[model samples]
Target: MGPDQALYVVATPIGNLADMVPRAVEVLQCADLVAAEDTRHSQRLFSHFDIDTPLVAYHDHSDDQRTARIIERLEAGETVALISDAGTPLISDPGYRLVREARNRGIRVVPVPGACAFVAALSAAGLPSDRFTFEGFLPAKSGARARTLEQLAGEERTMVFYEAPHRVADTLDAMAEAFGEHREAVIARELTKAFETFHMAPLAELAAWVRADSNQQRGEIVLMVRGAERKAGATLDDESQRVMKLLMAELPPKRAAAVAAEITGVNKKVLYNWGLEQK
Candidate 1:
């Protein structure tokens, strides 16, 4: 029997078309159908590469009907290729539902990896790439975004995030506030395209730079922040301990530790140990 039908998750270029892998092109050209995040936006890519495969829209709003249709095609031994408007399918894009359903139905899923904005940016950001977290995009609202940043303030793994042009400055300002002014960060903009730029500095300085230059606010942005330094013989601060005690009064020790970690960005283990010592 022929090899089992599969869904190919292909990655395209972030900006520069030259980065499109030959294998990805071949998969797109050969697939029976192409599931794209945005059919209109992907048209340019199809036109550029002369890929005439039938395109179907699949995005965040795509209902189960769409996914079911794709799975049905896969089950019938038809090959389908999934592509996001740019980069890899489902990095911060749609296709998760389709992929999951395909797997549950015993359909093989193959990844034709290529360009990814976060990976590309992290590779050259000069931060600790050994351990990193890709926190896709920040919340649109300033207050919510700040709260999210606060939760990750003590993250030891390098944090990567995507920000729209208009909110880039505000996001940087929030980062500066949540992670101290001296936290090192790298702002990579327009990556893999003409006018691509990378600016590295302390969080406060980076925020100031973006604020002063309107140009910096434009383009696709990947922001990388250095992980919190692990100090030797580190102990919980008095403020954190005080908060933990107050929480413990109203909640169980474990619950208090968790909440304290979220509010103060302190390590949960440390708080838990402190809580145990108190009891």
Candidate 2:
């Protein structure tokens, strides 16, 4: 029997076309239809590889009708390939709705991975990668953006974000404000492309560099910020302290410390001592 027809989510090169994997090429070549975030932008890659598969536009703004059409095609035993303008689809790009709809319709979804900008940047950003968060894009407005950063102020995991050239400086400034000027950060620009640059510095320095150098502000950018450092001898966070205080009101200090330790993963002794200080 022929291979089961499926929806292939292909990862295209972020910048350098050479990063496209052989399997991704094969999938796209064999796809009965290719759903691209931008038909014109993907056309260059298709032409470069000489793959003549029919292209359809499917992106963030695509309506339900468009997604329904793709699902209908997938249900009809035709293999469809989904691709973003660059990197994997649905990574701050479109295609989530289409993929979800296709799955609901019992269409098999296959991933043909290749290059991802954030992954590429994190791998080289010299930041702790054991645990991380991909916060795609921050709010464009200053107040909203600051509030968002404030919410993540205590995030201990490495943070990765995609930012537009125009807002890089402002985002960096807000990050410095929320995460602190001394927080280490890496700004990766035009990754995998000619003139690619990765600048590593403290948040304050990075913000200053971006503000001073207009060239650094222009490009496809990935901003990686080091996680919040746990202060020595002060392992319990503010939230844990608050929890401990609330527990102290209901229980004995020792019992409250023990409960807070269990709940917050903080050391019992630390919570006990902190509880004493609060009283």
Could you tell me every candidate's TM-score relative to the true structure?
0.86, 0.83
For model 1, the run of ten residues with the poorest summed lDDT: 1-10
Error of 2 at 89 (Å): 0.7
Q: By TM-score, how accurate is candidate 2?
A: 0.83
Scored by lDDT, model 1 comes in at 0.90
- Candidate 1 residues 1-279, lDDT tens each? 222358999999999999999989898888999999989999999999999999999999998898899898898989999999899888998989998998898889999999999999999999999999999999999878976786687677999999999999889889998888999999999999999999999999999999999999998899999988774544788999889989999976667989999999999878866665566
lDDT of 2: 0.89
Measured with C-alpha atoms, the lDDT of residue 53 in candidate 2 is: 93
In model 1, pairs of residues that clash are: none
* Residue 65 lDDT in candidate 2: 94
Compared with the true structure, all predictions reach lDDT values of: 0.90, 0.89
lDDT of 2 at 19: 91
- The numbered model that scores best in lDDT is 1
Top candidate, metric TM-score: 1
lDDT of 2 by residue, 1-279 (tens): 222589999999999999989888888888899999889999999999988999999988989999988888888889999999999888899988988888888789999888999999999989999999999999999988986786676677999999999999989999998788999999999999897999999999999999999999898999999987654456568899899989988976667888988899888867866665565
